[model samples]
Target: MALPAPTTAPTTAERIRSACARAGGAMLAVEGLEPAPTPVHHLLDDGSFATTVPVDSALAATAVSAGAAGVHAVLELTDHAPLPLREPVRSLVWIQGRLRDVPMREVPALLDLVAAAEPNPALLQVNSGITDSGTTTEPEIRYALLRLEIESIVVADSTGAESVPLSALLGADPDPFCAMESCWLQHMESAHRDVVDRLASRLPMTLRRGRVRPLGLDRYGVQLRVEGDDGDHDVRLSFAKPVDDVTGLSQAIRVLMGCPFLNGLRARGV
Candidate 1:
């Protein structure tokens, strides 16, 4: 069946933020340097993000010198799908901004903020614990915290590419289901062939015969990719109502399947 046009386009800010959070890591590109992969610790509500690298690394040195030179070096952060799929890259969020070294005096406060948002073991490893003799062990690896002062954000995805305004990005929040989406999708594809078949029945009669696979799932709906003889078609099965919690999501799926009794069975597996 031809997919119905969406009443409102999905917000680019939310999608970009969620994609970055889900990927956790991104390929950071700076001019005159090879792109380096770094773990993203937090996406601040201010439309900026924070990452850390070795203090002695080339990237850190370049950023420090660039700031001194009054040259605002552009940095691009590219995030990809964590799971293997027909199309591995779900979206890319490029931040055109100036990279600056976080001052030593502010390091502790910044780390505290990052930990409050999303803590990583690596953050803890930055410093060694105090010994019984009241002496602190020096850290083996020293890290330099850097912040990207966002000038602009460009997000590219299946729908299309658009530049999101800073105000919009700061105002929007990532989708609630993002963190668990990969696990849910992988589980549906691997162990629930029968459930997938049932979902296919909801498609248009003409397209029901195609190989139907669970393409993705979000709070708004479930998506299926139909690999047909003609080509591929993506169909989105929206929930009867938007769901915010796991219990509501379960009921939404059952409603979509037109079989309320199947809720108990699906619950056990999901």
Candidate 2:
């Protein structure tokens, strides 16, 4: 017997994506554009991998334009707890969930903004640690692969061998490359991945993981999550405004890349 269709509204991510938002701001952030990323190369000389960093697409022209238009709305990921009073109405908010620290520099600002914007801030059990340079460099590298959209490239190695050859190890380029992102981006990326992975597993229904790359803040609708699902899926609607230009958005993102926070709930286990 076919069960009657469930009557509840679609999840926030869903609603905005078409189950809510619309085509221009669907489940994806950088639709038909590019992905943000960094890369690491395993030197033939040594087993160690060196990073060739690419920038994030969330800071892309599309994202910036959407954000500025106030179309970039996000839904706070909360576990149905009592929310703070000063909820944000702009375009973003703090989701209540077991937040994996993404290590943004202006974390305090983001949190303050969320506190001001969101109402019922609940919590969820999610990956609590964080993503730093060492962990998610590959994703950034993936962004670099696009080649067309990418403007600059930064290659860094904690081992410091990429710039300073493992052999010579001296008198290498004294200054860092133009493409380099501060260490903080790595940490924030880690947080981004953890949430993405968990959501892929947790959502009652979702399009596909490969299509989406939760870049953070969707037109003030879904917080900490962005969908870019591929194949057979309606472009998830994102009620976000554009970032005007990717370069400016990327610059602003650079500023917010490692903000810290005191999450209300600290889950016991993974």
Candidate 3:
């Protein structure tokens, strides 16, 4: 069965950026090196991305060795639901580009750029125990910072796969609530199964037979994952209109649940 598309779907750039914004970790593959998985990464205001790897790891060593002339690399980021499901991954973003080390002198500036996106505590430890006298107090652990210069990007999801232009990516902004999507979806799954059931009722009868779980939420709508005897299916329920903030999102969700005046989400910081 053909899944319904959102009436007001997010643009490809917005969707790709949103996926990256929510991704907790990504797989880094440098040329001639084994793919390394790192939980520490941040997308900068520019199209490039910054990531930290253990100082002693081969990936870090490769960055150090590559020096001014960087190595070709690809970073694969997956967007998945926080809650467990038959298929957790909703989308995959592959970033292809050059990878090189960010000099220690410039690390602070990089951190500032990432801080605007997420004030991760790991940023503080990235440059630990270094003194003003140009000396070093070796900390228990040290990390090497590497930056990826985005040459091209490709995004794939249930709908299909396509390459997004760099110009569009640089200009697009992720959904305002992308950062809160995981928390909101998880809350619905755990605290309000009835809400999920009501939304699932809107799906076709074939999908209703399967176990339905919340997959994603955006200004446009909510997506559900259906796990059935055959396989998994993704269905989107677009809002009557797109919402831009929490109040509008709450109203949209309540409308989806057939209770426009409901106050179930306001107390929870929806």
Candidate 4:
């Protein structure tokens, strides 16, 4: 007989892409070099990644040597809750691929693609020509843009681990609320304990024994992490249906809490 299915609403591919988009930290590991600290990066829609490293750093030198053959590398991305909850990490995405430097001629176009997805200031600092002392000078290359051509992607979280196909990952879109989820969840945890209690009430009696905290939120539902003596339990309080906008999310959340008077989330904050 087949085993029971896991929650099917957010497919593995969707979860991988969404987690990558919202990842708070990233580390790149090449064959011989130590894991480089790469906090800012972007996962392009094409299932590849774009990141930067100091032009004079060892990693940049390694990439330059790799050239066309490309170096075997793994990029690990981590998604953590904004709140200081126990077991803060929500998910991990590992991309095993070939890493190479983006040709200087193509750097401009690659930056454009990365900027469109996530305009990190670090990217600007690379081409800004401003020295570490903040003095203006001729445009200088302070960083080297690198690309990871993905070979495979695997995502692991409370749910489990799964290998996602490149096509599926390319086709998937990040959660609509991914960028804002941290703020909203932070607001709920700090200001709306009553609402969280109400939502926790929906869980089974056994699960109610733990310390419940907001774990994550998506367009489909709110996730709560119950930290008990045995371990942590992640429960998804799904919306009656998938919601598209903040108004719908607010209504769905209110309905789940059985509190109709709850206010809507603001554009900038909750």
Candidate 5:
């Protein structure tokens, strides 16, 4: 059997237009959020501006006024479905109101928009990409982007990691911006340069394995100095992904501190 679209899938925008026979209507003031709870600002068209909620709202009133009738759902097609059941969605959103700036974006989490809209429940677009550094969820943005063709939305630049607000990302400026980890190389010879140098000078040519003692490994890596008849070497070794972070270095350092021979040297502040 075909997967069930919600038991109460909302009429399409075309259907809504036909039924209402109106160009653009309803100042559906969802009372409850802020004194004027931040108004739902989004572009009506390419140039038109409007709002879903009143401007001077305290933002607290939205909780009480927005009843259970929930925002309706609208569906449209994008690319061919990769799987039998999954159709690529472009965007999904309820026509709340015409606005100049609405907290919306092209992200992943917006899939929740599709699932939530089915129940016909008041879908609070809590994610404001900026001006509000709130919780982070990928799915919300995904679904929001899906409904952009028909539903009115306004997007903003990404604020990286310095998210301060829990509501939106647009209009918010983070002090320091952090991006995703781009690249990494495991077991880098470069990071082990010091240990390599130390070990090189000490490991004699054709050196036979002498009596073995269990020194210790540390955050820096492995600081096990081998005392062969040739010479003694205070060395550290590391084997870890190379990119950026304290893991390898930490292990190497720990090795220096934990190794009995090194510990004795360190205890004497050597």
Candidate 6:
């Protein structure tokens, strides 16, 4: 089915934020340095991003000096899919701003916020002196909390590249399905060829002959990529109603596939 274009443009802020939240880590590069991309743990909240760097690192020194000199150092934070996929990169967010050192007194509160939102085990290492393997010892990794005061934000993805206003980014929320999308899509592609074929029946007659593959899923609907002889086409199979949770989403999928009764059965097993 051909879905109507949205009345307004899709904001990249939501996608960028979603990617960052799920990624947990990002490739951070400081401007004027030889592309020394370092893996930094990041958390995004309140229109800004907080990252941790080793106190003795060169990057930390550079950022502190730049912030003291009143120079806004351009920093780039790139987030991608953690799972193995054909196209791993979900989105890229370029942040332009001045980096300031977060005070030692405030680091615990900030870490608490991150732990509450993400609950990543890495945060436990930052908070308690325990590693993933449950080993406790002296603090081996001393980190300095740095806050990037976002001046400008730019995002790039399959749709295209665009700059997102900081206000919009702060106001927007990530897609409900962002965390589960990869696992669900990968499962559909690998284990459920029959189900995919059945869902393809909803495609328009003219385009049904093309190779239809599951492209993506969101709160609004499912997307299928049709690779035809001429070119590729994207068709959206919107649900009968908006879904906010997994139960509603399952019912919506069953309705879309013309098998409302399938809810009782083990659909995932199929």
User: Candidate 4, residues 60-117: lDDT per residue as tens digits?
Assistant: 7898898998888898888888899878888888999988988878988888877887
Candidate 5 lDDT over residue span 98-214, tens digit each: 122233342224325333422212224433334346655443321111111223422111111121221232232211101110011112223544543444444454432642222
For candidate 4, which ten residues in a row score worst on lDDT? 261-270
**Reference-based lDDT, residue 109, model 6:** 91
Q: After superposition, how far is residue 42 of candidate 1 from its true place, in Å?
A: 1.9
lDDT of 3 by residue, 39-105 (tens): 6667676768888766777888888888989988899999887889877778899999999999979
| TM-score between model 5 and native | 0.15
lDDT of 4 at 123: 82
C-alpha TM-scores of all predictions: 0.82, 0.18, 0.87, 0.87, 0.15, 0.74
The local lDDT score (0 to 100) that residue 137 gets in candidate 4 is 78
Model 3 TM-score relative to the real fold: 0.87
Q: Model 2 misses residue 270 by how many Å?
A: 10
Q: Model 1: per-residue lDDT, tens digit, 223-248?
A: 88877887667788988656789988
Q: With candidate 2 superimposed using the best TM-score fit, by how many Å does residue 69's alpha carbon deviate from the native?
A: 29
- The TM-score, computed over Cα atoms with residue i paired to residue i, of candidate 6 is 0.74
Query: Candidate 6, residues 1-270: lDDT per residue as tens digits?
Result: 999764222246766666665665554456565432323445465666776666566777776676544335455555554335455555677777767776667878988886677665545434345567989766666555677777887887666789988888887777798788878877887898766787899888988888877876777788777778876666778876667899888887888888858465754667
Give residue 168's lDDT in candidate 2 (0 to 100).
33
**Is 4 or 6 the stronger prediction by TM-score?**
4
Clashes by residue pair, model 4: none
- Which pairs in model 1 have colliding backbones? none
